[model samples]
Target: MVVSVKRDLYGNGRLVKASDLSLGPRQCMPSSQSTATSVIFQQGLQDCGNTLQMTSDWLIYSTNLTYSPTPSRNSPIIRTNSAVILIRCYYLRHGNVSSNAIKPTWIPFSSTISVEERLSFSLKLMNDDWSAPQTSTVFTLGDIFHIEASVDTTNHVPMKIFVDSCVATLSPDATSSPRYEIITQNGCLLDGKQEDSSSAFRSPRPTPDRLQFTVDAFRFVGSDNSMIYITCNLRAVAENQVPDPMNKACSFSKSTNLWTAMEGTSGICSCCDSMTCATAGQSRRFGSLYPGHSRIGKREADPVKHWLLLQEHKVTTLGPLLVISTEQSQARTVTPLSSLVQLWVVVAFVSLSLVILTIFGIVGKRPFKLHCRKAGLK
Candidate 1:
């Protein structure tokens, strides 16, 4: 069904324009690799932007990118009116080509920034077992938030990753002036600094390329909104290299009154307290990766590769994470006022029934006596 949408579908000399076309909230982009004579494409629109008019409960998915319907690659292609959308997004309920054959599942969502297939980073809220991605973002207080940040290195060199910094904010804008810093100063868990905090890096690291951690579930008490977004900076380095202050994972131990390293020497954790962790012998190959770009939405693909640069970084935000408070987690339908109103209604109904019965009994007795007197034999 999507054969026409393939990168090589169009014939030679067919008109096509340069595009940075992307899909989904994570902004999955099409490959734009090219040479003077030819181009290579790695990904394509999943459904050729085909419109899926769904019923019987489905989520409407739509995207607005200009599209032109043309004949298949086998035939001479002629362009029609370019549709305003590049790819119309929609939840696939049931389809022959869908990946979810055993069970009805929505299409897979990918949110990663690829720097020329060298590295791509993604942040996800995981389930307790950390086996699969959690579908529901809603979380209750006192629950441990299992978070993971990973990189897809493809067939590239072996690499190690660090959760240099992380923060939780009430809004999606991670850099928004007001933010809560959960981890900072390279790979230090700030919450671990507190004796009562359960926040720390997962021990016996899950994998060399992944950084897993936990945060105590919480909410912004003063804010009315229940949503919270977690943003983190992930840095990658060579696997064989020794961990440094800039590339280490460190958590403070309250019982021992000392800092412990998850993979390396705790000395690297010393700088965490002063927020002075620094990366040594590094240059600005791709310049600085700030908290703004390459975020969850504005991900960019840089095909250009650097020769000596062994380090790359990305910032990702996973969010709208609903943190349910104690009061909010209880059933929402039952409230004090509603309960009181129901009680009053029942009382009023019973009172009206008693009055009706009493009136009927008085009239009935009088009728019975008058009938007896008429009979005169009573």
Candidate 2:
């Protein structure tokens, strides 16, 4: 009996196209009417056409091509020759190109990516000349101050930049000033220098590696005697080899935090409470990068969390704090002197005045005596 069997077509693995695989019948034993059997199989292959592929082992017989043979009641058959499928991201489903194909599975990159490799930034207070202040190191209320920021080469691909101001210390009234503001924000690009659009989402130009801004101390505080902390937050991304339009290239992979300090003291009364910080964009090189797609918004990240994570991430930069005083405070002598030195200066001044008075009294008496003698002689 020439028994034939057709294997099951459905499988769990990825199926290869007939062109990718070399398909041929398994060798069979020579028997009666072998030519007829071959002709029947060849006809079936032709009917299936170019699209059909033989993945599993199939048996052919002259007795019946369509008939499915079951195991004899006395004998059970164990069949083996299953196909292995390797599912890939580029495969087309059911030979349909119009329909969306299998998408590449994205695995989240290591959240522990080193901050240095991802992005870096710095904050500096500059003078009108754009040079570091030499004499006026402290920021005074009403004083026009300039600030400069530069990012590391790795993190120059930022999508948004933010400057947040807050009172680093608790006030006597048990209140704290913490405010968040967007300095430069655009969907996938940085704000242009000349663009006047009020919308924070528009980017008329490319992002720069360095940026600058000018701020008036009094205007920033609205009121005086508070320590202010300004931090820079940057949202950055990393990309993959293959790009797609149906979805983003990749999600935001890094966050960079750079900060500087300023103090608003009573002498230089500040309007920090009422005054807001100033911002500007400088020229820097920018490359095409993936747009931000994280659940975290541009300005919605928790300040407390960011502050806490700075230490954990080991990404914070330390620098001296700039003191901001009101014009009144600057005029007042805040220099401290030793009590002994002050007392000694007072005693020395009193002694010098008394000596001068005694000398004048002696000289006047001598002159008067001489006049009396001359009159008596006359």
Candidate 3:
């Protein structure tokens, strides 16, 4: 059988037909045997190519590479708190039977693959007053709230954000009907895209063209204390090119407002694909290979299709869970304790002095009169 030998040496390798070699090994070889070798090389090229493909897959697998989004290409590598590298060393030694043989039959290959790190996007409940991302906070009734999704342009690839579905539960129980109307959604768009002409934005608008975008800036007037669960779904793609509308993997109706449940028709937003569905989980996961610089050109196809490719596509959910409590207005009057005590003491002293003076006049005046009369008679 013929087999084709292929090697990529980064533009340094070459191929030579054995027939063209004038080496002593070729000279000693018989013509029929050399012809048979050539035939084998010619006939088994397809099978050899298949074998190489399988070998490459295995090599990538051994490196522990993952497809989740992660820091790549000169960006500062910020690993998850749970992230750790596994080091394994193998040792081998052998004595060569012949000097003509290659010194080593195999070489070790090492690669860094980030594992178990999830959720490339971050969800923050924006403080309207401070305009900063907040993990947990308290909100009162009639408070305008904004939920922001910040994508790390340095570490992660940018994608589209949609206010998938939001429900405010009056109680912690899952069976409660989530009121979607209490919190009204207004502004949501892709970064660099045109803003809503209605000028309905209540929260501070995000800086344009940045990796970050507001998933939904909403105002929730709480009629009662409840938990607000907002699910913001992201459709992250590697290539900037948008696929044909018909071929989109995920979609939703344009008329159906994302704040509400997915309806077949009559919603405000549309053109959603099948991949666009509401998902709920405590936290999401993101995975990517480290030292991505080494494998740049090797990724020709989109990362969505190949697990080893730069992890080109990621669909993650940034669900910002918030609690809204009813604002109670209790009137409290604060009095100065020092001034009040002084006033009470002064009033008591004046009353006591008046009582003593009245008693002295009533008793001592009569006694003095009687004594004076007795002295006169004597």
Which candidate wins on TM-score? 1
Give the TM-score ranking, best first: 1, 3, 2
| TM-score, predicted candidate 1 vs. hidden true structure | 0.52
The positional error of residue 157 in candidate 1, measured at the CA in angstroms, is: 1.3
On residues 1-378, what C-alpha lDDT tens digit does candidate 2 reach at each position? Answer: 222222232343433222212122222223333232131123332221111111112111111121123444588872333232211112222322233564435423322333324343445455676655333444565555455543444422232222332122211111334442323221111111113311111112124433445544432356444334444443222322111111111111123111111111111111122221111111111111113424434553543343233321111211122444665464564434355679889999999999999999999999889998989953
- The per-model lDDT (C-alpha) reads 0.64, 0.32, 0.32
What is the per-residue lDDT of model 3 for residues 1-378, given as tens digits with 9 covering 90 to 100? Answer: 222222211234433234332211112211333442231122222221111111101211001101122444698773322111111122232322245553453332111211212224444455655455553444444444554543434322333332323334432232356444211221123211224311122222243111232233333453433334443333333334232221122221234434222211213223222222221010111123223533324653333334223222232322223333432311112246556899999999999999999999899889888998989953
TM-score, cand. 3? 0.30
- Which ranges in model 3 have alpha carbons more than 4 Å from their true place? 1-119, 129-131, 153-176, 179-223, 239-327, 330-378
For each candidate, what TM-score against the reference? 0.52, 0.28, 0.30
Write the number of the candidate with greater TM-score, choosing between 1 and 3: 1
TM-score of model 2 (CA atoms): 0.28
